[model samples]
Target chain A: MKKQLMTGVLATLLSSTTMAATDITWWHAMSGQLGETVNTIARDFNASQDEYNIKPVFKGSYVETLTAGIAAYRADQAPNILQVADVGAATIINARGVAKPVEDILVESGYGFNNQDYIAGVRNFYADSNGKMIGMPFNSSTPVLYYNKDILAKVGVDAPKTYEEMEQVASKLKEQGYATFSQSLTPWIMFENFKSRHNLPVANKNNGFDAPATKIMINTPDMAMHFNKLKDWSDKGYYKYYGSDWDANQTPFEKEQVAMWLGSSGSFGGLRNRVDFELGTTYLPYWQSMNKDAGRTFIGGAALFAIDGKPKKEQQAVAAFFSFLTSPETQMFWHKSTGYVTVTKAAYALTKKSGYYQEQPDAEVGVKQLSLPGGEWTKGYRLGFYSQIQEIMHREFDNVFANRISVEKALNNIDKESQVILSRFARTVR
Target chain B: MEQRQQYTHSALPYFLLVPQIAIIAIFFFYPAAEAVYLSFMLEDPWGQSSLFVGLENYTILFNSTEYLKSVVFTLGFALVVSFLSLSIALLLAVKANNILHGKGAYKITLTWVYAVAPAVAGIMGGFMFNPHIGVFTEIFASLGWDFSLYTDPFDATFVLVLVSVWKQVSVNFIYFLAGLQSISYAVNEAAMLDCESDRRRFWTITFPLLAPTGFFLLVINLTYAFFETFGVIDTLTSGGPGGGTTSLVYKIYRDGFIGTDLGGSAAQSVVLLVLVLALTWVQFKFVEKRVHY
Candidate 1:
């Protein structure tokens, strides 16, 4: 009778320890300072409640982490939370059985989601057809124009706010023998950001949100003219081609060799520490003919996904952690440390009230740009295999910049090639 | 006379071979068969949805101009890299074998690059050929050459070949050096007595004897150029400057992993496998005859 009592006591101890905390694993790509911020948020959440232990794991770059997560899901070892890049968002979302919709998770956990709580551009980007949130927006960024103040001052021009003004400023700077402008060969800044800011559709089917995108829609006259203008700038030596390497132009911009550059707002905090020159930030220029006011710039960073097929208790833990992530305090802390845009209005207001924007006005450019009124086309890209499409764009754009192909030919080639990829993706879904 | 082992009839011999066969079956045959099966089907990135579209992937690949261009580029790249690396390494190996002073140091220095991984070599090459602050870029600038790897296809190809050949030469060098050292001293002395010129003696004695090694290295170098250069291409150019440097292996990787076009990538791998098989067959059937044992 005494031995039986001891066994009962051991069983009780084991069960109590196991039931004390539900461990929720989060596979993220954030590293360095950003990684530290992620860890802090996890630690804070763990400290606040003992029911869920939010475990954050650094899983390499955005691509590597997404690949790992997908492979893990296939093997039935997926984490509760997986961070996927903005481009890979479609891939993750299209895998219907792989992800548990944020709306469902939140509603089930008794913390219901309000679409209005998130910035329209951000919330809409991760929303489904019925406008329900599928994933939680975490680290978001938009491209903005950055210029060297002393170099622009020498050319006697303030930072150009429109495409026409940018060209005029380029001409003026060229007259002074300055390499007036440069940008990375990334289609993120040139195509996606440019199209959204000009209120143009990148692909058909309402930028692929209404249905699976079937064809390329970037062959319009407006796109031709915009590309031609860039070609003209290149021919006149007013614009420098930094090749396909994304960070190549950073050196020239920092060295003041290139007067103006289009760069990610996430780089603002790091840039301020890296450069010695006076820097200026502005919204990316839009074609006035297309839209007098700039449309909202889409977010570029990754979002957190709740993997499906986990236990209800585990998913509830994930939902609770996501609520904490969307809280204004966590958002503001993330923005301050990483320079990623605040995804929610409350976070923006809270950050503003703390005087963070006033102390660093340049950091406000990305957030402000993201919060601008947006049209149907201004929502983030929802195309499948978007990164691969970007690679095709990179190759063709490089061809144009190298003088090997004309702009029209390059666009046509991109259209034809991207159509093939889209059709293939569409075939799978069908 | 040496006794001929009749182990072919024994179950013990077969049992002994089980591990090797099992490894080959698991590692090679299974993946190859899966690739063949996948080639006929279209699948999404995560294997969530699949559609069996027989011959469509291959037909599309053949019709696609981009794939055709990549095929031509890959073939040309392999040929050039193989030829250049073999000849260069052979010359260095011969020099090192002949030299008595600092021979050990020279050989060690030449062989050091073999220890570096392909990705590491690509990274080092990337640093040296970086457009903005690369050492080679500065050198080219001083010489008044308009050099930009990101913009110029020729420049990109040149850098790719240079890095690939540099990475591969050390392995070929070790083989050639070993081949040179293995030539019997009596044969060299006899050739020295028979031939008046040192060059003539080398061509008559050393060249033919080293043909076996050269033949082996040619196959190795070609295989390296075809497949092993994926990391170098990925890190240095990522098959850029209008896809001028993309090889078949890199394309398979880009299509499958990056683009998530599983069926298309699978078809590409099958094509590559066939191409490699044909090349090997040709080499062993035709080229091996010229190589003296």
Candidate 2:
């Protein structure tokens, strides 16, 4: 009886310790301040729950992290959670059997999952047609206008509310020898913003999310007008065409060389830290003459994905942590820290009640823009083979910027390349 | 009995070489063979599965206009960079040979720059050429010229070739210096007795003697231009301004990694391998034959 009691006591100790904690590895690409925020959330979650411990690892940049995850998945050594950029959404969705749906995991774990709680646009991109959420929307943000208030005041121009006013301001700034009025030539900024604001279809079949095999719809007259205006500005020395993307332009703007910069709302935090001069934020300027009813800009930041290859118990752990991530407290913290829009309506309300926005007014811009009533364009484009399409778009835009091809020819080439990619994607999806 | 012993000793060297041969076959030959095999297959991006497509990938690569343009551009770039690097290296080697003071310091400093990572150098070069804030750009602007190297194809090529030559000059200079040092002082005395001009003496004696080193450098510089410059190209232009700055290897990276057309990229790789092999063989047969060594 004594020997049996001793054995039972040892077994009880082992069981208690085993039940005390389960470790889950989350690989993410957030660095610096953002990495600290992720760590804080993980620590809080670990402390709140005695059952599971979430370990967050800082992988490199977004592209590097995604590539590493893909390679690791192929090798059957993938992490439980991965942070993929917005462009990677379609790629992750198409990677069937490689990822677990958050909805299914939640339901299996007996945690009540609701799709309606999330912003429809943000939630739908990560969901299947039957409304299964594939990933949790984390670190989401939309583009906004950032202007140097000092430069604007010096040029005697208010922050431009309309595209025409922006043009006038740009001309005045150039005339006043500001060197550069604005410094980005990214298509997502120049083209996607225009399309979203005017409610123009960027692609057929609700920007190719409803149907994966949709052709490019960006060769319209309005797009031509946008390109022509940019070209005119380039010729007139009113605008300085930086390279193709944000990084190339942000350097000059950070140095206070450029007068205005159109960038993601998440950039508010970065500008607040980096810029010595006073900075002002505004909604992206729209073409007033084209349509009176222009909407918010498309979202640009990334979300979190739950990869496959874990057991049912581990999946439950992931679901729990994901729930904790999307919880009102975590979302509010993320928004207040990073200037990303709160993914959940409750988090937004919580932030408002806490008067976080009152302390930092620029934090409210992302929410205001996303909350606008403009239909599908506001939802942002989702398409299969999106990575390939984005590459083609960047390349053809490079061609235009290089003056190797006309805007019409470049768009036409993009249309052809996109169709080819779309057709291949169609074959697979079908 | 002596002849049999000599044959056994000669055969023992072959036996000794077996391990090295096996290692080469396992590591290098196996992967090269697999790459060749992969050239005939189509890879699905999402599925990451490859299917046999025979010559279809090669056909696509051949028909690609961008690939054709890249081929021409890469060849021209390689030639220009190789010649420029060789010339500068030879000049520096001669100057170092004549220098009486701080010769070791100069050599060490140049060699140290070569040891620095190409990616770091490329980044520094990018900053130095940045149109808005770069010191070089400001100076060029003051001279009344637009110095946007990132946007201009000619300027991009110039920067690429300049960086490539700059990075390589130290290596080639070391090789040439060693070759120059190896030559006997008797040759110079003989030329002096013949009363030849310095230029003529160099052309007739020093140049001919240094042919072996020059030939070696030519091959080394060409290969460097082909493979080693990818980091510089990626960091500097990212094959940008309408793919004007893309070299052959850069195109291979784009096609395989970014384009997700692994088979097509593999086919292009095979073509590149064949071209390099053929060129090397030609250089050995024709150019190396002229070397005095």
Among all candidates shown, the one with the greatest DockQ: 1
Candidate closest to the true structure, highest lDDT: 1
lDDT of each: 0.88, 0.79
lDDT of 1: 0.88
Q: Residue B150 deviation, candidate 2, in Å?
A: 2.8
List pairs with backbone clashes in candidate 2. Answer: none
| Model 2 CA deviation exceeding 4 Å by range | A1-20, A178-180, A183-185, A255-257, A428-430, B1-19, B46-49
Standalone chain B TM-score for every prediction: 0.96, 0.92
* Candidate 1 Cα deviation (angstroms), residue A130: 1.8
Q: Which digits, one per residue and each the tens of the lDDT, describe model 1 over residues B26-104?
A: 9999999999999999987777888999999999999988889999999999999999999999999988998989899
Docking verdict class for candidate 1: medium
For A1-430, candidate 2 gives per-residue lDDT tens digits of 9999999999999779756677788999899989999999999998887788889999887767777787788778888998987776766776567778888888889988888888645666577655678878888887778888888898898988888888888788888877445645366677666688788877777776676646867677888888878777777777667656457678777787778888888878878888898888888778898878887666667877888769777788898998898889999999988888998888888999998887788888877887676765566666665666676677777667667788888778878777866665554443
lDDT of 1 by residue, A230-288 (tens): 88888998888878887787778887788988988888888889889898999988888
Worst 10 residues of 2 chain B by lDDT: B42-51
